[model samples]
Target: MKVLKFLSVLVVFAIIGFSYWIYSSLNAPHAHSKTNQYIQIPQGSSTGQILVKLAAEGILSSPLPLKVYLKITGSGNEMQAGEYLFDSPITPLEVLGELNNGRLRTVKLTIPEGFTRFDIAKRIAKQFPQNPPEGENAVLNLMEDISLIKDIAPEAKNLEGYMYPNTYDFQRTVTTRAILEKMVGEFKKIWKPEYADRALQLKMTPHKIITIASLIETESRLDEERAIVASVIYNRLSKGMPLGIDQTAVYIAKMENRWDGIIHKSDLESNSPYNTRKIVGLPPGPISSISESSIKAALYPATTNYIYYVLNVEKNDKSHRFYSTAAEFERGKAAYQAWLKKERR
Candidate 1:
């Protein structure tokens, strides 16, 4: 009787211990990272292989219990292959659910309006470390595939101005080429057929319209003032005067990869076709990403003869004072210089 009782007590303790372990496996958080972590299960990986990878990634502390849980729930065979994001301190059940549901891991990448291809390249390089990692130059070369814009910009040297700026959703495994294509696709949605007609009426190529729009995009902060800025550009171009916008110098700096926020005298003097201060008419292409508002302004410039604009010092807004003559421009220039000097002091 004593031996039988001892055996029964042992069985009871064993059952309790097994039950506690199962509960812990189901309820306790398995992921060890302080931040969200990712575990990729390749296509056709077996349940055992998936568990082992989860263990290797430190997402699962002990694979045995989770493995048993998956098997018990008949979820083992349901685990699909893709990049899976695991929230830290997530329960094992949650991990299993995410994998079973085949929720693809996606990343949000925002390309701001007016960002150049140079800026876009750097951002892409940083955002995706390596689904076969690519460098900035490799991505830039990808942008040079002008086929994406062949219909709209047949003469485009590259896909610089056509990369529409907006928030984009990308699967973590998306290729670099695929990403650029999607962004260009977004731009197509905004580039209406009517806009192409407008461009023809203005005697501007679609590419040149986008280029001028890019100039207006970077020149003004307020939407209402973009038309005014576009008018200034048109007046300068009509009079056979240099567009002389300083941001073109910044654009030149970006293309050559030396952009440091300040325009260098060397940049102004360098005879790059993108440099508007030295070259008359539009740059070789769009200097930055173009927005639809700026595109509209380029298509229908306000009927103003004003050929110059200086920052409006009185309002301290990004708004500018439009001038029609050299004398008016000189006075505004002097005031701007005085303000700049005082600010520097």
Candidate 2:
């Protein structure tokens, strides 16, 4: 009878222990059940603010348990400031560890090849608005800062073609000038001293090379075709023929925000020095942001005798078919026009 009573008592204790274990498991400070998310702890945010943000993002179920956990673990004094990416279902304990350790995810910004200064300014404004307003005058003034544009083009008024197009990683608090400086610094790092000598050998200045590169950047999206486009520019320069590129006119029109869909006759007739159609040689400045491939093409053109190129209508992949005669170019243009009409329909 005593053994039976003792067994009954043990059974009662076992049930109580199991229930306590289940309750503790459910109410544990580290129990998390959500997925991937990014939490940005803004600069100068207090610990309470950060905790509230985390709770709001569903990283924590309640601030009470987190505060208790933080107090118990002595992590309240160790929260670092930065952007952090958290995996779903992460416990408050894990998040506390992340905050204390200051693990931050890098934000990527891609600057595409052939982006103009205006496009670049818009991009910068989107990424870092703490520096200046995105107005054209402000952007232009920022671009003209000699400390940024001097290495690539000292004589140029703006850092038009010098802002090297590439992917960059930056923190949230990074300023606009810092971003531009990094891009221009990359350009300077890549601009070899031999390139300047080579430019002189080609009887062109570095500014002129950048200008031609910008034209090539705007002319073709296909990296393989940049050299061909560069050859067209070279051929025009060699023959003293005007480089009749329409993108230059569009660029001018865009500066005044007057660019409609179609390029009017007056657009081609605009008196800007960037009007390659009216100019006898290279544009007065770069027409767009030049990529490394375009720069290479400008420095070393293809050995083809072709002097003209028209967009390939069938593929429409920004690739062009080059020609040595205006008649062949005219035929290509006719094909392109027909393709354009069909596309419109």
Model 1 C-alpha lDDT per residue in residues 9-68, reported as the tens digit of each score: 999999899979988887897547634556668998999998888887888787888887
Residues 154-195, candidate 2: write the lDDT tens digits: 788778888888899987667677778898888887778888
Looking at model 2, report the run of 10 residues with the lowest lDDT sum. 25-34
lDDT of each: 0.88, 0.80
On TM-score, the leading prediction is: 1
Give TM per candidate. Answer: 0.87, 0.80
Prediction 2 global C-alpha lDDT: 0.80
Q: List the residue pairs that clash in candidate 1.
A: none
